[model samples]
Target: MPDLWQNICLHILLTCPIFVNVWSRHDHLYMGLDHRHHHHLHYEKDNDLSLWINEMQVKMFSGFSMKIFAIDNGKVSPHIKDPNFSMYLPTIPSEVSYVNFTWKSGAKKYDYHFDRLQSLDENILKPPSISIKTKGRVPRNPKEFSVFLPCSGNVSGVAMFSIGLLIQTRKGKPLPGTPLRLTLRKECAHRGVYDRASLTASQGPDPECDKKCANNGWCNHEKICQCPEGYMGQYCTQALCYPQCQNGGNCTAPAICSCPKGYQGRHCEG
Candidate 1:
């Protein structure tokens, strides 16, 4: 009877599925079997949905890059080649909205972000902008004034004084490091008095003063020196005596003549 019972048990084991756990401490036996079919059955229903969500998340965080341009006087001008990843126009005029931009990536093309017209909150990604305006008058002469001379002592106080007068008369502000041209006039005499002519003084003259004399009859503000009569030039070096002292009995000095018997003043006036 025992052998028969053992044989029946073996038959039962072969007929029914057998399960055995390599390691188990519980009285109930732990089962191990191929669960691939059950796993597939549970996953099939939600596979499409999960894949779609992953794809959407990837596209959402892809970020955006853009370029900015300026539209002025009916002409479109490229202002910024490529701006930040995303651009928002805070205070752009409505007319400027008409300005077109072509977004390109691979073989795709899109218009301005406004065309997409996503959710209002999503579309409004940038903040409002602020603008400021400032204005000032244009200056007539931007360069500074300079006084150059052959020598530092060449420019006399009188020359500087005269230059001050000229500047004052013209209401001009003198600046430093500016170039000035000193030109002697043809007619040296004005109002019956010989007005020793001097040019606008500059910072420093080239070659410096070779001769020892004040520039013109004017004394330099820095170096005040009286010009000797009849000796008139930038440095009182050139004798004013010229044109052979016309009608002179004897040419004593520049612009001066000593008359004979009947002659009187300069030019030997009879």
Candidate 2:
């Protein structure tokens, strides 16, 4: 009773009824996996093994052939299931775009000085609407990125970050099931026992961009306008809206959806 093209791979499911997720201890980042629908072999399955990284490597488990261990601290125990996912998998995108995320806390301000943002091909990424902040900056080489809160005076704890992004096709159309949020938690140690990066500026704004920069964004060393949230382009002229305008919805500003008469909801999918 299988379809004409679904005969052989039917018996061979990606994961059996039960599965265990992989583990990580590398002090890099946190990522979340929004589940995708899988009706393989005509079975409604949500227990397939998820993917993760360890020691800066894309972990490859042939099947659900990994062991998952749990550690509880007070009321915090981590889980790896896509609990609230309800969408089909999208086709592969030709390009990936990461929105530069910056955070401001308390009275402390940070200026992340980097040469240029690199193009990363991460398997998972969050959307533009999600708040992805970071406490530190990898000024030289950025491998994995996440959101973090600024800690001061050797104050150490833990934080989670989701580097949201957009996936687009060759002709520049936003793919569906996108703006996927990836979260990773980092445990920080107290001072005198850890490595640290100078995230905050000891001085004032760069003279090159003090008065030249437009909008509320900062001017980096290269005199480029590091635009504020909900904006993009070299000069931050274009407002960004990921999963761009569906059902003829007009996106006048960042994440601001202008639905037509017959459609509603953000991105007008509802």
Query: Which candidate leads in TM-score?
Result: 2
| Alpha-carbon runs more than 4 Å astray in model 2 | 1-96, 101-214
- Per-model TM against the reference: 0.19, 0.30
On residues 1-270, what C-alpha lDDT tens digit does candidate 2 reach at each position? 331112211222232222221234322222221123112312432122122222211111111222221111110112322432211112211111222332221122222222222212212211112112222321221222222122222444443334343333334543343333434433333435432211211112355654644557566554445555455434444554544557888767766679999898867877
Candidates in order have lDDT scores of: 0.24, 0.32
lDDT of 1 at 248: 40
For model 2 the TM-score comes to: 0.30
The lDDT, on a scale of 0 to 1, for candidate 2 is 0.32
For every candidate in turn, the CA RMSD to the true structure comes to: 45.7, 20.3
Global fold similarity of model 1 (TM-score): 0.19
lDDT of 1 at 125: 17
